[model samples]
Target: MEKLAGMLKRSREDWAYCARDIMGVKLDSEQEKILLSVQHEKMTSVTSGTARGKDFVTAVSSLCFLYTTPRFKNGDLISNTKVALTAPTDRQVKDIMMPEIARIHRRMVSKGFGFMAGELQSYGIKTGHEEWFLTGFKADEHNHEAWSGFHAVNTMFAVTEASGVAETIYDAIEGNLQGNSRILLVFNFNRTTGYAAKSQSSSRWKKFRLNSMNAPNVLEKKTVIPGQVDYEWVNDKVSTWCTLIQESDFNEGEGDFRWEGSCYRPNDLFRIKVLGLGPKESADTLIPRYWIELANQRWQEFVKEGFPRHDVLRLGVDVAGMGRDSSCFCPRYADFVDTLKMVHSGGKANHTEIAGITKVTLNTHADKYTGKKAMAFVDTIGEGAAIVPILAEQGMTNVYSCKFSEAATDSGGNPLTDLTGQYEFANLRAYLFWAVRDWLDPSKGSKAMLPPDDDLLQEATEARWKFQSNGKIIIEPKDDIKKRLGRSPDRFDALANTFYPSSQEAVAQDLSGVFF
Candidate 1:
């Protein structure tokens, strides 16, 4: 306790020292009030003692004028506020506030203000947390009811997460504001991290919870609920629960099915988008220009640029029980049915169709004179299992076999280890996993990157399938299409593997010929 007290004292002294520096700069009375308000907030919870502490507090207090005390416009305030408030103890506030602390905080608040103003102009605030509350933005500079109404819900969050109070506080916030109509809740999970708020809970609040309400536009009267909201008023509660589950497990596919960052989500209310192949795309769906773009601007600038793309081949195929969908084909086209006790249906492809796809892959992608590098990725599950190995044997060594299930069995068709660890059939799967997971951070824009084709992009967007608590990317058959598209993303798996092999340890011997 004594040691902690001493540190606090030092912090105060440091503030005072900064205050002295701030006083040296020129400033007027309105600016002084804003600065004081800021200082008061900083000092309210802290002990103000020692010259250093006093000076530090005084300096920050003066800087607050840049926002509220008016003579300085927003631009002038932002430009000089950092210099005015350069107190050593300021860094101790937290990581998020360390960089452009004032700027980001101001931006967050300003953005919040703009958003709320837009809401008011179009619709209006519904009340409750949606009263246009600001979580991490500081309001010490101005006592104006307009800005003050924006509470620091996330400051409490900062205090709570440290004490493992997140679960409890999160529950309280949900309980307190869940049913209120026209109310917006700004839940801040990453406030202290300096990164803009991005988390499962934040995503849920923005996408599922807030969006679910039938609030009017910002120009209209805010929606009002006389009493607590009935639980039934919500749609897709199960989906929200699933989103929370996704966040806890670090599911990566964002935008479309769900998103962690700035990706669009699918609304059954909207029609699906169809992309056609143009000069950049072949009837085979080969995106050569996209590949060249990825290799040039993104990769060559960063990683070993000239890694010889001529050798990389992509194989495309499908996986299913030996059957045909009634919607797409005759049910009688189903060659066989399932023996599984749990309502299983068998799927087998007509040999003629499989031969055709295989022949096309060979002609379009694998000819020696094509001089382009790439492979054909084929789905290796169910009906696909029957033909992938045969393709591999037919000198298509780049034939990537897909095994979607971690509980999948061996060649003898018996369950073995998890799917990610299954190396017995093809080493390519392992290589692909590392390439996506280890090589790239989806947010930072990777250089050694290959943009996914429309099909791959669709799968990547819909891949709501994620790791279980045990850290495995679990993809259930039923939910696979719901999250990954109309079918299991077998083509995506093969392409991902070929482009970003799981490992470069043992190169396929056949690949040596492509180097020439």
Candidate 2:
């Protein structure tokens, strides 16, 4: 028994031994690579296909780090040997990782391994000490500060589902890695442009890629050899994927697997979910991804350089009717645009709460940019018309009601025409969207800026446009966009309303003045 205990203690330093011996966990070849990379590299990133044991790898790596590290005399954790885990949501950290850690710890204890008396709590592990033995955090973009102020000698910081975590949170975790600390980032290869995909080119990170086919159970009968057992647990995973692909009519050819039911096409979804590749932009997108990227860059620069205090601010509101869609408000100062608020009322918000919040946003911006005038353009469709009168009651007299079906007019009260002048847009909504396109066009020499919001970017890119038989440009109906996206493009609509050409004088004014 003494010899067995000593051997188990030594195995803590070897993750594979500890997992297989103490916890009775078995890892395949790719999972072994992930564990070894965590031990040997200062930074490791793994992008893998679905059901490739990512969570299992994370749990084993975390336990190995925790059990092997040195402890202090008072039983308090030595700052040098702490383990921190983070995910995009608290539920992931608490429900998923914590349970796995607790299960392994319980198994080890039952097998007579000398793990200290500890109970795994929701977001942490609690031993006899008042302070938590282990901690987990939600790496929200707005809450980067919460991830900071941690330093340790041989720390292990693990980010699960890292592709969904914000870049700012990653930056915060990077700063916290000190001394001989290491970081492990694991996620599905869901996006082509985020930090996870970009990390492959970075020399500092040791990267790993695994696919569903890598699992031993997914192999054909001929692939299995004597003494090497197949992973029967993954048979359902293989069967479901095969069935989904076979049933999909969109499959280009035989042996070509496609998931037709996904929001993205089969090829794109397959690349992201099964083949462990970054997502490729679809060819049919309306707004180019580059435009949104450039806009985000310009917005970041504007924030760093300081918002022009002298610039007049414009506000745009897209109201929700009796629906699940949100009421979105966007405020623009010069080239920079900020979504002031997105209120999800479940179609239950009272008039007073909505009106009060709108009034507060206007007053706050008005106070910030003293001596500058303010204008508001509001969507008057459905329940939105109620807000116009409410704003007027609040002494915001510069508000304009915008009806999508109304005829658009130029400053001279004539029918508004596009740059080509051959034909006008079908309605005011189409005209506003074209104006937004022109404003975002790099060739137009407009450095228009937009917030780094994923929903806004999706709305801007996915909303399509068409030319009417009469030669007028017509944007796709909002209902169609809502059906495809699973939500209304309220953010994009609010932004477009801000660029409505109500008066030529307003457009010509250099709102930035000396501040520019």
Candidate 3:
């Protein structure tokens, strides 16, 4: 107990020393710098790679901030001091940060630190007298109201996973900053335009960038403390990253292997998540921004006259399934394409409603192109499987079930081939996206038209593509794109399906089907 008191007295002068000697928390060199910066700087922003001990640093810093600040007049404990810890989600606050805080608090109590007294609860820690407390809350746009009423002269407000939190939530947290208070934001810099990214350039903020390669043991090649056993956790992390880089194919020929393999090709997912750098613009996006602008321009010119008549009209329908995503229907004839119409139900749209919409679109186009069988391509995944047969039963026999995961085949049931005469492409999803690229290619003499819709334009420009080892093209999956964009690109999916070849001759027959 005497030794604990002496250490506690010493900690009032040096927080980093206290953490290392008293708390037994080993911080790497980068983490040590960050800890010190948080203590001194008004705002500290840390962008780091995965598994870099960010949580551990945050936990120890909370304790140090509480222990070193001036105490209340009534007792030895720090008074009127509040530490607010928040994240993008409730699960992140309750499951990740709160546990780490509790663990550190328990360790301090076990070491006979008499000055520290707090009940370690699931939500937060409240020291004796309730004057000093560490609280956790979910900070997103929906829950911004919960961040109110925290006003303290000595306060440290910290946010974990700041990249995922919406800008409005960050603004709410910032509004509470008052005299002598500090703010800390830590995240794996994922997106190009978040509050976390914007803060990096602000003169008031001190920023730190760290990655697995710069881990404590990895950089020093030995333990910092004498008699400290080597765990090799840092070494394992570096090895895993190195293997992924070494094994990835660089067939895209423009960016690094990590960028090519990423779902957001040529973007900074690798630089931000693995190298701890700022976000970079995607170089090899599936659909260029200019292409979408040009397509919209072409549509404006084409719409001057009424819908042009053609021998065949194709309709592409993407069902809403459970209605979480909008159901989209796109109809096209030659160079003229109709604007996509998206519908939604409060919940899942009934099959009757899906089939009714599909039938109406098909019948209207079929009447326009009289004596011709207008083909309708319906996505046959999930609820779509039931919608296809319902459309056929409604006398729309020309409807074809387009399974995105199925093997790419021509209209004649022959395997589809790329320009290189080798079967390349993991599935039909890739084939459809490539077809969209070809349709928009000005060099091909195919003047395509599209609606002037910003949502569709954004979706088209953000889609990414990669080439396989055998030189086959692959499109980023919708689920992966949804993670980055927060919603599925349903309109773009329907548009791509419209570009499916109507004749077997459109795709080569001599190439062999090589699945990778």
Candidate 4:
């Protein structure tokens, strides 16, 4: 009790004391840094990999922010101070964060600490004064009103799972930050945008990324901490969950990147969920800026510098008539794209005429390189379907009608995955775009040299993708893309169609049973 009195003055400035003495927790190095950062900085952002004890520390700091406050004039009890602990969902606050806080409050009360007194309830601790309290609730994307009325003078805002909280809610929280107020955000670091992303990315906030790779246990390859991130677990996740782009998978017609693998999905999830780096930061995107800029630089160098035109192996046609969308023809060499043709018919050409134009365009594109019509892919989903039989009648035997809505296929003409595979495609649209993304990867020895077309770059980079509930990568529908960009992604679509990721055998299998 005497030791507790001596610590009162230091408690206001020292969160480690409050954590160790009052809460009975010995924070790790990362947690200690977080606690001290919250002590001095107005805004502290914590983006963590799996099992880093950030939530535990966040709960501890929130509780400490409440208990360490100086008392009112009438008593040695706090008043007119508030700490708000919020998450994207009520269950998270009620089940995970608030419970930890309640347990700690109960421990402090049981230990006979005389300086602070508050009623410890379910998810709140309130002082005798009506205004003094610590509370937590759901502050999801839609709940702008939830952050309102939290205008306390010595306020502390702590958000858990903050990635799910929307920008409007963050703005509301920002508006309420006044004198002696601070905000702490702790989250899984999943998203690449939104206020949570800004908190990590923007220099305004002091940020910490608690990667599992750097965890003490993971580094030591042992259980240094009983429940912290471990080395073997990380190895398991890397082998089972993450994948690098392998060009031979498409070139050899052996594999398709079906989001998830037979069981292990080797993609960017490992970067966010395990490595804890900011990642290539491609969440919510089809192609990351990292890869897009790579292709752009290639265009400025090899293609823009007037490289020799080689034999064109593939030609892609995205057909649209007098509608808002333009008919785009993308010609891709073995490694780059230099020539492109776009026709905006201005409501003058029908699908039949467009088909005739397509056949002429294909012949022209081929004449530049192979002097014969190359194996071509035409978007035969809508009005473009009329162009298929018209071309077949024109003796265009090399063209394959592309049904964007058809089921995705691998190098071989299978459903999507064999029995051993786990991931599924949303449609052929996603599969083709994914192939374009793979083809444009800078790491590949033969990355695509693209024409530096602005619309192509915008559509290629801005197209969004997300995983379905079953954990399959799904591209945003073209209609949604049009809504966001205010025009159809015709050039990008044509560019995407250039990557028909199938070998000769796969094509033969598709032609045997599939429609032209």
Candidate 5:
């Protein structure tokens, strides 16, 4: 009781908590101090991005046990007492708040007071809808250098052979209201990387197979085309990612952390900080920024291609209504066409029209496309059936309504499915997964895809696959996609489905006068 009273006294005086004892177990003063310091550091100085404090805290927490290491034969009175008081919660210390404890000791040696501020800023109170706000604290970035170094080590170790080190290093890196909620982050972080090596080694990565057990919060949005392991989530906004690009030595004069626009300035350690967390509602605010940047970059790249050199062309349209999702038009057979255009369905009608015009402008060689050009329309899309018929009326003989396979079968008696056929689900899904793998793991880039703005490619990346015990796979959509990803990955899936086997066969078929 005395130890508890003493700890509470210190916690209240030093950490400025409204109350010390919460529920029953004594609130840790040491943990509070470290958390405060971290919070202080974050809002004031830059310390190793936003994840270093957790790393430091965990390291210190592990060392806390050293004080109880049977110092005396019977154990010193004070040491024994400390251990006796804390041992009951030993599991919590080692597993739950290890990082918080580590931050304290690290601060003591580093003489950094900013740690407290950083912790406070990071300490969040959740309102409904997965929204969070820093309670009685402001965001800061004090120990940028130290924090950056910490993140670098943590992220690097996480992706490399030192993943275990990362687990222990950043055990307290979450802002969940309860340990259970926070532990989910840890579990996902660890499990998500189980086959990371395989995913990264390939130039093209298949969607990772995930179950509700592996990720309960995640909602399945859709599956990849075919023959791949890619999946999409419709709504699972509660997620975060932190990575360390490199380590730096402050002796070289580079600070630990620096953010220039969305890109973090490369420190001597080459720290690359990437993190995403917030409510589904707020996703709208940030997603557009990423998309705009991505789309513009893609557009610029497309413009540089000058124009297509192909004399004969094959064009396609997969349109969408201007809802939350953007509408898009993709022109494949172009001379200058590279896989740089950020095309999708569900944007503005203007963008759709613009994309169509851009595709034609970029690919349609005036001299070559005079009479040899060809195009197709999948009537299922928005304005697709209507637009194609109108175009056909205007003498565009290439327009035709899409049809599901009436008589198609694979070698082994498998129904050549309309959903899976035209898209070449097997190869297309595999290719898109490989693209994700290349993005996740660049070193082992063996199975890569050619650069093309295929909706199927994007959809494949968003597709979610589940590998059964027998190795069979399934793809489907989830209701709560907003929680899984900031937005619906349906667009990406739709694009991936474009390359299904049936679609490939359809494309290969000569349509000289089919519409007529």
Candidate 6:
């Protein structure tokens, strides 16, 4: 009891001490500085390189303040302290921060701090007082109003990976900076001109910069820090990303030249990735912002007038059970797509849940699409494959199981070709994304339309295309995309699956009960 009291009192003022001693987490010099800075500074900004524990420091410090701040009298908090930890999106929060929070909580419980954090809820940590707790939020960068409305005696806001975050989110935070409040900013320092860059440059924040050269592990050429950006990893990145843009020192513009025949920026990739510096721009994105805006404008114009008549009702299911990502459902009528619906699968997504939801959605849209026209294209890779036989047994002939890892083929299972009849489409995933690209290309006179969702738009544009030596065009892998963005592009993957050519096949002839 004496030791507990001492730790709690020190924890109120010194978060680094709280983390190292209380949580048993080993922090390098830079990480310790971030935790200490968060206490005295109103805004502590960290522009960290890859694998530098950007998420870890923020999560630990926030947990430190959240559990130790509240003074309880008969189970009611003396100061209604509220910690709102937000990422660019809800999925990012769930995937990056929440898991870190859970891990820290596990460590705390093991070391005996379960008494402070009463219960771990789906959103975040809960205490005796509902108003006095820490929670993770999903912010629509455009809708700053929804992100507001928490004014407490003690308020803390932590934003992870602020690169492309909407300025409106910062505006919302400005509104709530009252009483004993602080802002914790941790990100990759990815850009030169965004709000994230401003956080690094502005005098309002106490900044800490970390990169490959300074990492203890890289210097010692061993496991100095606990992450992957060690000596061997840095050399690997040099071999892969630093090849085309060679220079005496790792700096900007060295990699502006072409590597092989691809137009990808190898140097800028190294700059933002390894050196922890921002590029002039994210220059290699496949889709343009203007084209997406055109699509959004097109959707609005169509909404002003009633939607045109289209018969087939198509649905795409990106299956994810537990483990950070959510299962998303995207429904469309021929060319016009509807808003996406996603469910948080706290456990494994069994056949019953997905099938029942599919049946329910089909029944709801029964006015226009029925029988052969109502098609549910389910992603049948990994967790999805288990549901295939069960879906077959359910006799939902309209549902087709699609394996994204399979080779790209036409409705007749022949290899795909480009405009000039050359080889194209490295895999089924790439083929679907390319089809989505075509559907969303506003320059093609706006043939198809989808809901104007910011997350959807961000996911669609973030994907870049690369060409293989064999002349096959491929979209960036899902794992790689997940690394850049905090979670799987679940929403966009759901959108892309709806473009499977099996829709035309279903219209032609219903080939039921077989996995594609």
Estimate the TM-score of every prediction: 0.29, 0.48, 0.48, 0.51, 0.34, 0.50
Q: What is the lDDT of candidate 4?
A: 0.72
Model 5 CA lDDT for position 211: 22
The reply for model 1, stretches above 4 Å from the true place, is: 1-311, 319-348, 363-374, 392-400, 406-445, 448-456, 465-487, 497-516
Better of 1 and 2 by lDDT: 2
Could you tell me how far off, in angstroms, the CA of residue 142 lies in candidate 1 after the best superposition?
Answer: 44
Model 3 agreement with the true structure over 36-68: per-residue lDDT tens digits:
988888899888876666776787887788667
- Clash numbers, per candidate: 54, 1, 0, 6, 114, 0
What's the best-to-worst order under TM-score? 4, 6, 2, 3, 5, 1
Question: lDDT per residue, candidate 5, 136-221, as tens digits?
Answer: 11111232232222221011111111122232223322211121111101111222232221221122322111222122121123
lDDT against true structure, model 2: 0.70
Candidate 3 regions exceeding 4 Å error are: 1-6, 74-79, 114-117, 220-267, 282-516
Which has the better lDDT: candidate 2, or candidate 4?
4
As for model 6, its CA RMSD to the true structure in angstroms is 18.1
Clashes of 2: 1
- Compare candidates 1 and 6 on TM-score and give the better one: 6
Ranked candidates, highest lDDT first? 6, 4, 3, 2, 1, 5
Which tens-of-lDDT digit does each residue in 1-516 have in candidate 1? 696446334434343322333223322232233233343332111111111112222323422222222222453421211111211122222232233234323343453323211121111112122222212222222223322222322211111111112333333333322111112112212122111121211212221112222222211223232121222322233233223333333422222223234223332221111000112222222122223233234433433443333332344444345443210110000111011111122454554456455555456644454464334444454565666555554555544444444332334444333324542322334334433432343332333344323334444333323444654334333344544244554434543434423232123333434421
Model 2: per-residue Cα lDDT over 1-516, one tens digit each: 798768757675677887788776677878888887887788988887776667778888877776666456685655445678889899999887888787777777787664552666777666664432567878879976676546666677888888888878778878878776778888887775567765643446887777664556556533342223244533433344444432334322122333224312234555556656555554434565557767887889888987764767788888877865578888887677864578887886455666677777667667465665577777878777788777776666566777778666765567777655655888889888877877776655658888877778767876778788987778888989887666788888888888777563343233323211
Q: Weakest 10 consecutive residues, lDDT, candidate 1?
A: 329-338
lDDT of each: 0.30, 0.70, 0.70, 0.72, 0.30, 0.73
**lDDT (tens digit, per residue) of candidate 6 on 454-497:** 66765776688888888788887788877755567888888888
After best superposition, candidate 6 residue 456: deviation in angstroms?
39
